[model samples]
Target: MSLATLWALGSVGDRLRVAYRLLSKDLDMQIETTAVIRNVQKGTASGDLTTHGLEFDQLDPAQQMAMKAFVFDRQDDALEWSHGAR
Candidate 1:
């Protein structure tokens, strides 16, 4: 299936799963990718993923949604990597 289709149809977890699967060819790639995702998830949960050390909760709702989309897209990009892209 195409990524756009998956992105349109899948939930966040599903997208992450597909991303990880695509990265599975390289152990380091998988580890690093998942680590970043985990950190973002942690920040989302605890409100700490800010450049100014402000809690994520302190951000306006639009900023919060932007952050989530940024993190999610980063994970999605993992699915597009090639050996040279690594």
Candidate 2:
């Protein structure tokens, strides 16, 4: 996964909007900050994702879908990774 993807995965909220400042280190990794969207709907709750000063195309499809699904389901523990052996 890319840094952008990691950042998106770490995001938590019904509606998510992120603004990332790409530093030199990020550029070294070929990561760029543009725009991201996360939309979710569950029961009587609905959320949206938006980013400022960023291009939407910068986000990966999987990351986008993951955000949407997470928001829609109102779940934040869907993809937890254990540090040690299971």
Candidate 3:
């Protein structure tokens, strides 16, 4: 469950919200609405950027991993697989 996978799955918004809540109170991340959208688009188009916020540098390893997992988990449930076993 990587950030790139989440963005590709169109779940960046959810992950961003979670990360914002987890870090906003302790860090300086503001979770800019427009910036989040722009970052998603950029990540999708260029695939060069790893993160989209000023606070990304401040997050610890655990927080980063948690955010990635959150996004992946949400996306995992949203996907539909017709051939998979129920």
TM-score of each: 0.30, 0.24, 0.31
Q: For each predicted model, how many residue pairs clash, with residues at least 3 apart or on different chains?
A: 1, 6, 0
Q: Could you give the candidate ranking by lDDT, starting with the highest?
A: 3, 2, 1
Runs of candidate 3 with Cα error greater than 4 angstroms are: 1-19, 22-55, 80-86
Residue 32 displacement (Å), model 3: 13
Expressed as tens digits, the lDDT of each residue in 1-86 for candidate 2 is 12222123423233234454322311212233344334322223234332222235456765565445545443333333333334
RMSD of each: 16.5, 12.6, 11.5
lDDT (10s digit) by residue, model 1, range 1-86: 22222113323333233332212222223211121111122223344432211122144455445555656666666756643364
lDDT of 3: 0.41
Distance from true location, Cα of 9 in model 3, Å: 26
Model 2, residue 41: what's the lDDT?
22
Clashing pairs in 2: 34-54, 34-55, 35-55, 38-49, 40-72, 41-72
Q: Which of 1 and 3 is ahead in TM-score?
A: 3
Question: Which stretches of candidate 2 lie above 4 Å from their native place?
Answer: 1-32, 36-55, 75-86
Best by TM-score: 3
Q: Rate the local accuracy (lDDT) of all candidates.
A: 0.33, 0.36, 0.41
